[model samples]
Target: MATTFIWPFIILQCVTVVVIVLFLRMFLHRQLEIGMGRIKRMDKENLEKEVELNDRLEKLNEEYDMKIQNAEKQADSLINMAKETAKKMRDSERVKAKEEAKRIIASALQEKEKVLSEATRMVNSKAVDFSILILERVFSEDELSGLRHRVTKEVTGVLFGSDNVGELIRKNKDIEVVTADKLTAPDRKYILKMIEKQAKGKVNVKFVVDKSILGGLILKIGGSMIDGGIAYRVNKAVLELREEI
Candidate 1:
């Protein structure tokens, strides 16, 4: 009877162990299903987030590329502008330099002309003075006197032929005669007689001797003067020479 009771107890314990094992297996299967669903959901969310991140990255890269292109274009435009500005400045400076050079050349030419004119004037003046001195030293008194007589005769003829002779004599009662040397008594008498004949009236006569006449005669009547001298001729020649040069 004891053996039969031990066998039944042993069978009951085995049945209890089997029921607990089945319940534990069912619980473990439900938990496994929940864990699988959570894992699938997390995987799907991670894939979406990765796709979004990729899209954002692509957009950011495009924007960066566009910005880089714009920056390069701006840099190129600025470089071109700077180059153009420099070219303009260089051209302007060149023009200014050329203008300044032209002005300097013009000023220098003017100064050169002024200096040449002054030198020419001085040279002509000295040449005339030297020629006068040489002529004065070479000609004797008698030779100079003959030359004076001839010039005086010509001047007298011209004066006598003029229509204003009577008016000149009437306007000025005093007649002044200039000569390179003192006239001889005969020449003086002849000149005075000629003057008195033309005047048709008596007049006071004044005679002046100036050796600078260079063997010619000069006549002064009131404010009018007749210059028939070698010096006057030389000065006129010099003026003509200056014009030619």
Candidate 2:
């Protein structure tokens, strides 16, 4: 009876330990599955936030590119304007320089012309003075001799001539003989005797001996000069020729 009762109690204890072990294993497995699901949900949320940040970065890059393009366009316009302004300034300066040079040249030419004109006038005046001196030198003693000869011939004609002079003198009592030469002893005796036969004391004789006269008897009874010298006649002819021009 004791051996049979001990064997039955041992078998019941082994079954109870097996049942406890199986229940513990199921509980631990369920707890592990719930932890893994929570980790997966958190990872999904992080990926969504990352996508939004990437999109913002792309928008910022596009704005930066647009700003850079605007800056380049503005720079190009400024450079072109500067170049045009510089070109206009250079052209204006060139024109101003050319006009200044022309004015300077014209002033120099005017001064030169004035100097030349003054020099020419001085040279002409000197030449005229020289010509006058030459003319005076050329007309020497021969000129005087020619003058006397012409005067004598004119005087003789006036006293007694074949032309109308003789008739003119006989009609006028104012036709008295007037002489500038001195009456010598022999010359006065003959003239006095001839005057007594014609008009007494009416013929007045004035006397003078000018070497410049070149020897001539000048008689002026009327408002006329009777030129008898060669010089006076020749000089008158030359004067007439000169007047023709």
Candidate 3:
């Protein structure tokens, strides 16, 4: 009877221990599964947060790149504008300089022309005066007398050699002769005879004395004049000198 009782007690004790051990194992496994689930949920949340943060960083980077590109473009535009402005300014200055230079050159040329004109006028006047003085000094009184006679003879010859001497004398009806000195009675007679021969009739003869002729004869036939005077010769020389100058 004692042995039977002891065996039943021992079997009951072992069954209880096994039940406790199995209960402990199931509880620990449930707790472990809950911890594992919480860890997985935390990992998913962290991964989602990391992905959102990466997206934000990418957006910020893109905005920054756009801003940088815009800044670069603006800088380039400003540089180009400055260059264009500088080029325009340079061109304007060049044009102004050229115009100024042209104006100076034109002014200089005008001044040169003015000076030349004044100088030419002065030279011509002096040349004329000098020429007249030289002529007056060169001829003596005796030489002048001879020159006057020769000149009068030449005038008579020229008048006689004309194609229509008689017609010219008749149309004019008055022949004016200019001399530096009064003629002798014989010289007057000779001149009057020559005039009548050319006129083929009686003609009026007018003799004018002008010492300014220097010593020569001037014959006026109609509206024409034949000048063979020292003064006139000097004037012709002055005119030629002016042309040469």
Query: For each candidate, what is the lDDT?
Result: 0.81, 0.57, 0.81
Candidate 1 lDDT over residue span 31-132, tens digit each: 999999999999999999999999999999999999999999999999999999999999999999999999999999999999998998788888789777
In Å, residue 21's CA in model 2 sits off its true spot by 9.1
lDDT of 1 at 206: 86
- Arrange candidates, best TM-score first: 1, 3, 2
Residue 98, candidate 3: alpha-carbon lDDT: 99
lDDT of 3 by residue, 101-128 (tens): 9999999999999999788667756766
lDDT of 3 at 233: 66
How far does residue 209 in candidate 3 sit from its true spot (Å)?
A: 26
Q: What is the lDDT of candidate 2?
A: 0.57
Model 1 deviation from the true structure expressed as Cα RMSD, one decimal place: 9.8
List candidate 2 stretches off by more than 4 Å.
Answer: 1-44, 121-245
Off by over 4 Å in 1: 1-3, 6-11, 121-236, 239-245
